[model samples]
Target: MSATPAYRRGMADKDFDFLHGRWRLRTRKLRDVMDPTCTDWIEFDSVSEIVPAFGGAGNVELTSLATEPPQEALTVRLYDAGEDLWRVWYLSTRAPGYMGPADEGRFADGRGTFVCEEELGGRLGLVRHQWTRLDTGRPRWEQAFSFDGGESWETNYVTEHEPLGE
Candidate 1:
């Protein structure tokens, strides 16, 4: 067998290669994203497109949530070769002129978990986004928040990506 390529051997450009394509996102989220006690939930169908950019050093996901008034969201994932980690930034039509504090982490054993601090409703807390089963036909993404400095986490958002025309 030949030696493994550098990008495949360590954290490099190909980390997000599996996500490049079109996807159908079935999303379920809490009505109040910051409220751990909130049980009210909303489900919707969204379409997403992921394109590999910067020669696979990064990727971008554009999602259109089919909710009332029709909203759109964008996620940009960039890999830091030197740091051997990835940083994800998010932007949304739901929030005007906001692109955020990136969640940073590296993928291990087919799972990727990233965390960042965010202020929701005048309260600063920890936000986490996880990507799992990415090598499968159906990959999953989930979001959670913790108010007590990562002591606890409440999952508020989840989406399973079904490959389009697979």
Candidate 2:
């Protein structure tokens, strides 16, 4: 007999429902990703709007950052029904036609961990994005990179998401 919990066996398509609507995001990012000793951090604000698509199997998020020169980005998330996982892709105005690497994972116990391989300063690295605090009114997201094949990680970016008009 299978002992896996039903929730783990089949996650609902609405797993990302909490992310819908408008959010005000505060972000702190490392100024230099390659420098392990770099303590310089850049703080910025951004507004994000997310909407469901593909009959709940997909979602799209548009973000506009309040940086000095202003910045915009889009994230497309598609859920693979066959694998019961979600794949995320990012596109930023700074990088025009280039779509970043895909981060693929599934939410478990209200937390989501997505990982992908990326190139940081001409060196290969493993990137991880984690979503937590979903039960709280304000959810949090963090990004980390590991150069030693996941043996260690350096958190480079963090975003605090506050629901707008709440």
Candidate 3:
């Protein structure tokens, strides 16, 4: 018989259950994520709905923003119980055509940090997604990018999720 992976030993399927609901989103993003001196930011309010799928092992999040032309996005998250990891994929109307790179990670101490590499300004760079304050009843997410293999990073986006009454 094969032994189970150590990371999977105690991991549960309810890891993402907290996301199954509607939320009001306070979002901010840097105007130029790759430019060091571009401190300008755009902030907006939006709404989101997360639906559970795959019998609790996966979820789909749909977001809508009433921007100038109206905007929408979708995020898909899947947890691999046997691998003890979660993978996320995102697509935004702001960027048509291709879905962004996949981010893979597992929760630790009520926080989840996922990482992936993607092209930025014509060069490959590392992108990090952070999930924190999860258990504190105030969940937030941040995104950062690093060109030096994580030796340095600059936060480019943040979203504070406020749960709305059903």
TM-score leader: 2
Model 3 C-alpha lDDT per residue in residues 23-69, reported as the tens digit of each score: 99998999788897899998988999999998888899999985657
* Runs in model 3 lying further than 4 Å from the true structure: 1-10
CA lDDT of every candidate: 0.87, 0.88, 0.86
Cα lDDT of model 2 by residue, 1-166, tens digit: 2244456454556667789889999999988867999999999999999999987778999999998789899999988766777899999987899988899988887898999999978999999999999888788999999999999999999999999994
Which pairs clash in the backbone of model 1? none
- Which candidate, 1 or 3, has the higher lDDT? 1
Cα lDDT over the full model 1 = 0.87
* Whole-model lDDT, model 3: 0.86
**What's the TM-score of each model vs. the native?**
0.90, 0.91, 0.90
Better of 2 and 3 by lDDT: 2
lDDT of 1 at 140: 95
